[model samples]
Target chain A: MPSISLTLNGRSVSGEVETKTLLVDYIRENQKLTGTHVGCDTSQCGSCVVHVDGKSVKSCTMLAVQVDGSEVTTIEGLATGEELHPMQEAFRQNHGLQCGFCTPGMVMSAVDLVAGNPDISETEIREGLEGNICRCTGYHNIVKSVQAGAKAMGG
Target chain B: MQNFDYHKPNSVDEAVANMQASDDGKFLAGGMTMLPTMKQGLAAPEDLIDLHGIDGIAGVAEGADAIEIGAMTSHSVVASSALIQSDLPALAALAESIGDRQVRARGTLGGSISNNDPAADYPAALVALGATVKTNTREIPAEDFFVEMFETALAEDEIVTSVSFPLVEKAAYAKFPNPASRYAMVGVFVAKNADGVRVAVTGAGPSVFRASAMESALDGDFSSSALDGVAVSADDLNSDIHASPEYRAHLVGVMAKRAVDACG
Candidate 1:
């Protein structure tokens, strides 16, 4: 087993994990951060997305050991005590999610997208969300939510 | 995925040593393809050598007449790089069209060519651009690097260091991607250089191959009209549920023309 240490959500965390332990599994099973859903074990579904060193990546496709010494931010870390992150607040205000299965990943991916290009266009947003699959087919609202979130984040 | 010992080597030599010492070992780049294959039980290596820890192998540089991109450089980096965008926008556009944003954030140029997925887009660009694939041992021309589907000329202990793409007068790539996977159903890359025109097609065949007939036609006129009645033979094209061989053959002509037009 490899002893891995990483800054999770803002705190230093360490664990002894098998080489095959996926980052998603390490977060969900070991660290009890269940907010990051596992909609598709494969990389197709971006439901397992998390921020690794400020970049969005599919946690399920990466090994826990691979992220050792990196900064990981899950959905649970998005909120500030009582206040929701602007993206989460926008999702709440715009009704971006249905059944809430893909919301976390969608929100995380959208945040990164808007952060990279604050002036993103509608077509760019649609293309940017290609990696995430919303089973409920509620992309229209999701796009609106991201637009609102982007504006709220001063994009 | 099966349990395998992981080794993170700081240098190329150390990574190769780790691979040579293990009975069965695999070098992991971005894990975009290798990890999924392992998860599906399609591949199981006894030892996994992670190449991410190695420094000085993951950036882009520019020379007088060409661009040198490190093997570990991610697609996103290449796609967004100002240097590549200014000097080689066609390659940058091709990189941006790969997979999606998240995959582009992780998938590396080296890994994509090394895997040589029949439907991958990079092989077409490499072949058409006349790129040189640099390795730990020697430099392999793009034409020789790709042997067949999912196979390359890379030796067991060799590791790709970087790739050098020569600047051309004009170049463009166009692809009809499979809707679901974004892998090219039929992709074409056309380039016009000092020597002449080179056209490479992927996803329609078992491996990336040059379209000599279309190249010759374009070399004469360097316009899409030159390929007016030209056609690619369907004899060696791949036939799958997504497209029939004849359909892919048709796409080869269509995409080649599109690429040529986009080159302007």
Candidate 2:
């Protein structure tokens, strides 16, 4: 077993895991952070998206041991107790989710996107969100949510 | 997934030494391709030696006569690099169009070349630019490195350290991507080297191959019309869900023409 330690959702967590244990599994099982969804076992669907050391990564595509000493922020970490993060609030206000399976990853990816690029347009939003897929809502609300979130974030 | 002992070496020497320590160990660069394959139970290795923590393996070096990029440099790094953009804009474009932004950030040059996926873009650019792939043990010319699909001439335990591409007069890469997967259906990279014109095609065959007919035609006359009568035999081409061998052959000509135009 490989002993891995890292900051998850602003808290430091360490555990011994199998060499092939995925970051998603560690987050869901060990850390008990089930907010991060795993839609496709393959990396095609970005439902397992999370920020690794401030960059968006598909958690399903990475091993838990690979993130040792790195910072990981998931959707559950985005909110402050009961108050939602600005992006989450914007998504709620804009009705950005449908079935909500992809909402956690979508919101996490969107927050990173908006933070990196503030004055992003709709086309840029679409391209940035290409890695993230939303089956419901036709992506209209999601795009609007990102735009609104960017505005809320002064982006 | 097979059980494997994982080692993240902090230095290049450690990585190379670890690789040489065992024959069952595989050097894991960016796991963009390897991890997925492992999850699908396609590959079952006893050990995985990660190369990410090795310093200096993820940078772009602008040399006097050529640009040397470290093996672990990601596609996003290459695509956004001002040096790559100015030196070879088409390479940047091709890099940007690979997989998507997520895969671009994770996939590395070394991983792509090591995997030698027939549809990968880096091999086409490497071959067309007459690049040299430098490993820990030796340097192999791009033309000789790629042998077949998912295969390379690299010996066991040989780790690619860097790739150096000569500054060309002009170079361009054009690819027809599968909409769903974003892997190239047919990718053509054309470059005007000091010697003459070089054309390399990927995604259409079992390995990246030079388009001799197109190269010969363009050497005489560098024009899209020069490729009109030239035909690539479909015998060795790849037929996948996205494109038939014949369609890929057609895309080879079209993308080659587009690359030539872009290079001009």
- The weakest ten consecutive residues by lDDT in model 2 chain B span B97-106
Considering only chain B, report the TM-score of each candidate against the true chain B: 0.99, 0.96
| Candidate 2, residue B33: how far the Cα is off, in Å | 1.1
**RMSD versus native structure for model 2:** 1.7
Question: What does the lDDT read for residue A87 in candidate 2?
Answer: 94
DockQ, all models: 0.82, 0.73
Q: Candidate 2: where is the Cα deviation over 4 Å?
A: none
Instruction: Work out the TM-score per prediction.
Output: 0.99, 0.95
Candidate 2: tens digits of C-alpha lDDT, residues A1-155:
98989998899888799999988988998888899998997798899999999888899889999999999999999899999998999999999998999999999888888885667899989988888888998999999999999988886
